[model samples]
Target: MLWLAFHFRALSLEVFSRGAAAPAPLVVVEKQGSRTWVIACNDAAEACGVHVGMAASAAQALADGLVVRRRDPSAERESLAGLAVWAGRFTPSVSLAPPDGLLLEISTCLSLHRGLGKLLKQARSGVTEMGYAATMACAPSSHGAWLLAKAEIEKAIREPARLGSLLAALPVALLDQPPAVVEGLERVGARTLGECLRLPRAGVARRFGQALIDELDRALGRVPETRAFFEPPASFERALELPAPVQAAEALLFAARRLLPELEGFLSLRQAGVQELELACRHERRDPTIVKLGFVKPTRDAGRMQLLLRETLGRTRLPAPVHTIVLRAPLVLPLSASSGDLFQARNGEADGDLLLERLRIRLGKDAVHGIESAADHRPERAWRPCQEQNHAAAAANRHRPLWLLPQPLPCHDGRLQLKSGPERIESGWWDGGDVARDYYVAEDRNGAQLWVYCDRVSGEWFVHGVFA
Candidate 1:
C-alpha cells in the first residue's frame, strides 16, 4: 500500500544545532541507563519551553538547564542514506525525501513483510536503531497516512474509510492550509477537518482558494499521487564508512577496494564505462575530503582505476583519520572500440583518452590541446587548437594527428614537390590584410606527411599540418 513519510525536522534540527537533545528541568528524561536518558515526555519537553527554532543558548537562559553540542550534517545525511539503502530491502521503490523523510511503496511489500503492522514496526526499529524516532502510517493512499503520522494525537488508522473521520478531528494545520486561512478558520471556530468539510465548497474555494480543497482531495484519495524514486545508475560510485576513523592512506585505499567491484558491476549493467569518477572521504575530527580522477576515454576496468587510486592514495597523506567516504562523477561516456591495424586506426582507444583527461583534471585545461581544422588556405591558418569532445569522433579521427604546430614552418625552396595543390582560397580583402593561398599535400625530406600550401602571389611554401 501507500506509506506516509514523516520528517521530524524540528527534532533533527535540534540535534543539528546541538549534538544531543539537551535536558530541560520541565522535560522528563526517562532514565534508560545511568548516563543514558531518553526524552520520554515530548509535551514536558515543550512545557519546559524547548520549542523548535529557539536557540540552545536562549532555551538554557529561559529554562536554566539544557544540554547541547555541535551539529553534524554529514553524519545525519549518511545515516539517512544508509536507512534509504536498508529500506530498499523491503521495496525497490524507495524515495528519500530528505532530512528524516522516506516514501516507500509498501503495497506490494506489505504481504512480503508480514502486513502493515509488522512492516511499520520494522521501519520504526530500523530508524530508531539508526538514532532517530519515526511515527509511521500505512493506508490505501499516501496522503491519508502522512496526515495520521503527523497528527498530534498519533495512532495507526488501518481502515481506509475510517481515515476521514480520524482526520476530521485533526487541526487545520494538518490540512497544510496557509497560515492566514488557518487563522481565518480558527476565528470561525472551524477547528477540525470535518468542520471545514461541512462548509460550502464554493465559499471555501472563493475564500481560501483551491489549495484547501486540493490537500483535502489528496487526503481523501480523490487525486493521483506519485513519487519519483531515485534510479540506480549503470555505473555507480560509492564510498564506505570506515570500521573506525582512518588516517593512513593505505587504510583508505583498502576501504575503496570493497566498493570498486560494485562500481564495475554497475558500469557493466549499463554497457558503459567509468571514464571519470571521484572518491571522497571524511577524516576523523576533520571535514569530508574528495579525490577526483578521470580517464582519457571511457573504461569499465576496475583493476586500472584501483591501481591508479592506490598510487594516488599512497602519495597523499591524511591530516586526520577519515570517518566516511563519497564518490561521484558528473558524466560517464561509452567505451571506445579499436581496429585491427594498431598504427592506422583507433576504434578502441578509450583507456588512453580517459587517462589523459584525468591528467587534465589534475593539471589544467590548457595543458592539453588538439588540432582542429580551420576554413583557411594559408598553411598556418588552416589548423587551430581544440579540446577533445565526442570520444568516438576523436577516435575516428585518430588517423589524423591533432598537433599541427602553431605557425607553419617554411617549406623547401622554389620548385615545390606539391602532391596536390591549387585549392585556391581568398578572404578578408575588404577588411584589411587579405590572403591568397593555394592549399596542397606534399612530402618532406624526412618522409613525413605534411599539409603544405603555396602563397599564390608571393610563391612561398609553408608546412601547415601532419597527416597520419
Candidate 2:
C-alpha cells in the first residue's frame, strides 16, 4: 500500500495554536536531565538568538521579552488525534505516528481525490489551515514515509526499490532505535544509514539486535508492517482556546473558521449535513454566550456556512470578552449530494431562503415567518403564520385573491359591476365564528378587480380581498 506521512515538525509549540504566529518571541522548552532545553522556538525568538536545543537560561538571556512555555505532550497527542479525524475526509486509513507524525494509507484513495499531486496540494493546505506546520512524504511503506517525513525530505518515493537509496544518506539518529544502539553505531563510524547498511548484516544484527534489522526491513518495504488505523469520532464537537481574550466578532469568526473545515471534513466523511450549529463563547467570570445558527436546509458547504455565520455575528453583541470557543453539531441528517447547493440560485429564482435566514438572524425568529392555510372557512381564521411552511396542500378554492385584507370592509354593491357568479362558503358553524357569505368577483370604475361577498343573513356586502 502507498503510505503518506505527515511529520508535524513544530508540534512542540504548535499544540498551543497548531501553527499560529505568536504575538511575541516564544519558545517551548522541555527538561533534559537537570536543565531545560528549548524544543521549539518561533522565528521571532530565533531572530533574537534563541534556537531549538539551546538552554532555556541562555535563550532567556539572549532575547528580551521572550515567552517560554513547557512542552505539553498530552496536548500534542490530542492535537494529533484531532488532525487524524480531520484527515478522514481524504483517506479512511489513518494511523497516528506518535509525538508529531501521522501515516495514511492512500493507495485506494489517490484516484478518488483526482491524483497524488492534487491530493498532496489539498493535504498541505488543510494542514496549514488547521494551524500546523508539517512535512509530508510518500513512499511504498508506512515506516518509509514516516522516516522520510521525519528527515524533512518532503518527496514522494513511488518505487520500493528506490526507498533504500533515498533513505541511505539520512542520519542514523533519525531511526527509532534505542539510544545505546545508535551510540554504538556512531562509535563504529556508522553515522548514516548508508554506512550502517553497508556493514555485515549478520554481525550488525547479532551485535545491535534483530529489532533494528527488522525496522530497516520495514522501512525498505521488505517486511509487512501492521499499524492500528485511526477511527474517526462518531460525533463532531471541538473546542479551541484563544491565545488572548477577544471581544470583537470578526476575531471570534477568524478563530471559528478553523473549526469549520474540520466540521466539514467530519460531515463529508459521514455523507451528511448539519442544519444547526451552536457556538459557545466562554468568558472568565460570566456565562458563555451561546449563538445558535440555523439553515433553511441541511448543508455541508463550509464557505456558505461561514458566510451566514459572518452575517449572524454582525448583529450579535457580545456581553464580555471571549477566552475560548466551542463548536458543536450534535445531530446530522443524511443528505443527498445533489442537495448540497440546494439554497443556491435555481431556475433564476432569487435566493429567498438565504434572505430569510439572514433576516431571521438579523431581526428575530418571531419576526420573520411563513403562512399556511388553516382548516377553517371563516376568512379571518382561514390562514395562520408558521415557522416552517407546509407545502402538502393549498387552499381548495383556486379563485382566492393573493392579497387578503385583515378585516372585511363594508361597502355598497350598487357602485360595483359584478363579473363572476357568487361562490358560497358556508362552513364553520360548529364554532362561534361562522361566515354565511356568497363571494363574488367585482370591478370598479378604476379597473381594479375586488373580491366582495354578500352576507346571506345580514344582506350586507363587504370587500374582502384584492387581486394583484
Candidate 3:
C-alpha cells in the first residue's frame, strides 16, 4: 500500500494570518512558566530574525510592528481535523497525525486520478486553496511517509527495497522517540539514522526501550502499521472566527471563500447537490444575522453558488460587526444526470431556471413567482402563484386560456363569432358560491381569439380571457 502524508509546518501562524487584513510580521506565542515563547512564526516574522522557540519579548525587540497572539491549540486541532475530513474527497482512508499532519492511504485511488503526479498536484492545489501551507511526501510505509513529510523531504518512494536506504541518511530526530533517547543517540556519535541502525540492536533496545525499535521497524516497513481512519460528517456545517471584526458584509466574502472548496468536496464525496444554504454571521453582543440562499434547482457547482452569494451580499446590510461566520447546508439531494442537445446553443430550461434565480436574488423572493394549477373549477380560482412551477400539475389533461382577466367582462352582441366549444363546468357549491357555465373559444370583430363563457342560469355572455 502507498501512503501520502501532509505536514502543516506553521499551522497556527497560517490560521492567524488568513484573517489579517494586511501582511505583517506575526508570531504565535505560548506561555512557558513565567515567560512567553514563540511556537510558530510567519514568513515575515522569520525574515525579521524572529524564529520559533525565541522569547516573545526578544522577537518584538528584534522586529518592528510585530504582532504576537496567544497560541490556540483547540483551533489548530479543529483546523487539522477539518482538513482531514476534506481529504476524504481524494481517498476514503485518511487519518490525523496529531497536531499538524494528515496521513492518507491513496494506493487504491491513484488510478482514478490518472497517476500519482496528477493526484499530488490536485492535493497540493487544494491545500493551497484552503489558505494553508503544507509539505507532502509519499512512501510505501505510513511511518516512512510521515517521517519524510516531517523532515521536509518531498519524495516518493514506491519500492520497498529503496525505503531503507532513502530514510537512512535523515537525522535521528525524525524518529518518534523521546528527546532523551535522541540526545543519547547524538552523544553516542549516532546523529544519523544509518549510524543508529548500525549499532547492536540488543544494546540499543535495552538503552532506549523497545518502543523506539518498534517505531524504527515500522518506518522501515518491517512492522504492520495500524491507524483509525477519519469519518466525514453527514451534513456540512463549519464556522470560522475572524481575527478582527468586519463592519461590512462585502468584506465577509473573502473569509467565506475559504470554506467553499470544502463544501464542494463534501458534496462531491456524497454525490449530492445542495438546494439551500445559510450563512450565519455572529456579532459580538447581538443575535446572529442569517442570510439564506435558495436555488431554483439542486446544484453542486461552487462557482455558480459563489456568484449568487456575491450578489446576495451586495445588498445585505450588517446590523453589527461580524466576529464569526458559519456556513450550513440544511438540504441536499442526489444529483441527477442531464444530457445536452447538439443543435441548441444551450439548454432553455436550465437558462430559464438560472435567470429566475438571479431575478429572485436581485429583487426579492416574494416578488418572483410561477403559476401552477389549483383544484378549483372557477376560471379565476383555477390557478395559483407558486415559488416553483409544478410541472407535474401542469401536465393534467385540461384546456385553459393563456391569459385570464382579473374580472369577467360582458361580451358585445355582434362582436362574437364562436369557433369551438361548449365545455360545461359546474362546481364550487360547498362555499355557497356555485358556478354553472358553458365555456367556448370564439373570435371577436377582428381576428383575435377570445375565451368566452356563458352563465347558463342567468343567460349572460362574458369574455373571460384571450388566447394570445
| Steric clashes per prediction | 18, 2, 0
lDDT (Cα) of model 3 = 0.84
Question: What's the CA error at residue 97 for candidate 3, in Å?
Answer: 0.5
In angstroms, the error of model 2 at 191 is: 3.5
Tell me the tens digit of each residue's lDDT in model 3 across 1-468: 999999998798877777544547888999989999999888888999999999999999999989888988998987887787678778889999988999999999998899999999999988877788898999999999999999899999899778888789999988888899999999999998889889999999999899888988899899899999887888999888776788665568877777777887787678777889998999988999888888877777666677778888888888889988898999987764552211111557656666787899998999998888788888788888887843554663334577889999998665788888898999989998899999989988888888889999999999898886
TM of each candidate vs. truth = 0.44, 0.87, 0.83
> Candidate 2 — what's its lDDT?
0.84
Each candidate's lDDT (Cα)?
0.61, 0.84, 0.84
The sequence of per-residue lDDT tens digits that candidate 2 reaches over residues 36-90 is: 9998888888899888889999999999988788988887777787888788889
Residue 158 Cα positional deviation in candidate 2, in Å, after optimal superposition: 2.8
RMSD of each: 14.9, 3.3, 4.1
Off by over 4 Å in 1: 9-11, 14-53, 56-83, 96-100, 152-154, 232-281, 284-468
Highest TM-score scorer: 2
